[model samples]
Target: MLPDADAVSRAAADLIGSAVRAGATTLGVATGSSPLGTYAELGRRVAAGGLSLAGCDAYLLDEYVGLGADHPQAYRCVIRRELVRRTDLGDGHVHGPHGDADDLDAEARRFEEEVRRARIGVQVLGIGSNGHLGFNEPGSPLDSLTRVVELTERTRADNARFFDRPEDVPRRVLTQGLGTILRAERLVLLALGERKADALAAALTGPVNPDCPASVLQCHPDVHVLADPGAARGLLDSPRRR
Candidate 1:
């Protein structure tokens, strides 16, 4: 609940910078307008010679299935344009879940293994309007593994602005499981606007159940959730919604 989105981004960027200063070598990155400001702040710091991501390895939390590597809306390309290309981070140090793989199951296993080996120290995330973490939609199991999932209609429609038409958004994606995300040493979740108010409130104060996947964040020991006034209105207006 900082002043606004810009303030929230500054706080988030400070947290990330602290992690890097503490020798954190692996970073988990997410795609979405919610995190764009934070990435921009980081890039500003790098430009000022106050930070460097050269020593860090970045991991993607999810990727749309069936989108080609060249797709503009692909998580890979989005991250590149928003984060990687803006900072010292290079393509060689970036890793993403292979959503377009021929063997989806095998790809999931490999991605999970790679993430486990890297042992991410800081993970950035953005909450979907429907309480999704990454591409993990409502009803995603708390202990699920890296795997494929169908995009909720609400999520598809929310992302339609990134495509030419509502039908152009990918129907499926490969996302890191709740379990995988919990393994990170730190987690920062960003929520913005009134559109995310209901979901953020449910996730923060409601029961920890699959019906609200992001509710599982309550189980994380080092999770930090940042939301604007509109998004935090529910939490502020009442002690609990459930």
Candidate 2:
């Protein structure tokens, strides 16, 4: 496990930079407190001429429904402010599902098609205290695809810090499915703090089941998990946690 959040971020950035340098054409970026440092490190790398993401297509893991284009908490806007604006990523090539679409189902289909058309070579993720990945809450099926999902109260509460109040958080989201996330050539997950300990442990060491949506990563061929001391505490008992 990393010594602190900053170390985790640097390690994640190193992997992502390596992927880009090795000819990866598509990258998936995740938004949340856990990944913010990693994005910052990527920005520093680009500024130093050590990395470049301008040639890659970037996809967001999820977006809140009904958030306006200017909504500061909107995942798209957050991504723009945190990663795209901070690095060499092209603004026009960053794509996310149209969460506020008039026809949610159709939009889901379209977004999934877009992601599949240009596969994501690398994906970054963060686990929710409730075991969610990309808004796929605890009960999400292993084979689920990109779709709209009602936000779990627990998940909403955890994300409330991003908004002015708990009620201000959106009630629904469009997120890539477990299957869709697995399609990426490689995956990197960063989980920090004691709050994420249970889910983090379960995702890496527990059974591959729907109860913990992120547990589906166990089926993936390539996945790298980074956790701080607090988050890795539960893994101490599981040899399989590796």
Candidate 3:
């Protein structure tokens, strides 16, 4: 486990930098408190001219349904403000499923196609308190594709801090599915705080099942989990690694 979230961020930066230097142009990224530090570090490197995302493309992991692109709490807006604007990627290079689309199913299919064409080289993710990856909450199909999902109360409650009121949080979201996330050549999952301890342990050591969506990562060939001590506390034995 990492000393803290900052260390995790630095480690993630090194990994991402290696990928970028190795000519990986397509990236899949997540938005949330967990990724904020990582994005900040990457942004700093880009600003210092130590790195560049000039022609690289990024796809967001998910977006809350009913929230417009410009909505302050919208995942798209959050990603743009937190990462894309701070890096060299153009407005058009970073894409997200249209949460406000009239035909959400069609939009999901279209987004699935877009990612398939891009062939993501690296995917960064954050697990939910309920062991979810993206918005694929408990009971989500293991082979589900990009699609709409009803947000769990736990998730909505966790995200409520971003809105003025708990009721203001969207009830649904469009997210890349476990199967879709597994398509990436590499995967990095981050978790921090004691709040995530149980979920982190379950995700890494529990059975691979739809009941705990993040557990599906166990099936991936190249999955890296970065966690702080508090988040790794639930593991039976040693969870930390160099």
Clashes of 1: 0
* lDDT score at residue 178, model 2, on the 0-100 scale: 94
Per-model root-mean-square deviation over C-alphas? 1.1, 1.3, 2.3
Better by TM-score, candidate 3 or 1: 1
Worst 10 residues of 1 by lDDT: 233-242
Candidate 1, 1-242: lDDT as tens digits = 87799988999999999999999999999998899999999999999999999999999999999987668998888888888888999878889987789998898999999999999999999999889998888888999879989998999999999899899999999999999998999999998898988888899989999888999889999988888888888778657745
TM-score of 1: 0.97
* lDDT string, candidate 2, 73-173, tens digits: 88889989999899989889889987778999998999999998889999999999989999999889899899999999998889899899999999999
Put down candidate 3 lDDT per residue, 12-49, tens digits, no spaces: 98888899999999999998899999999999999999
As for candidate 1, its clashing pairs are none
Separately for all candidates shown, the number of backbone clashes (residues 3 or more apart, or on different chains) is 0, 0, 1
Q: Model 1 lDDT vs. the true structure?
A: 0.90
Q: Which candidate has the top score in lDDT? A: 2
Candidate 1 residue-wise lDDT at 28? 96
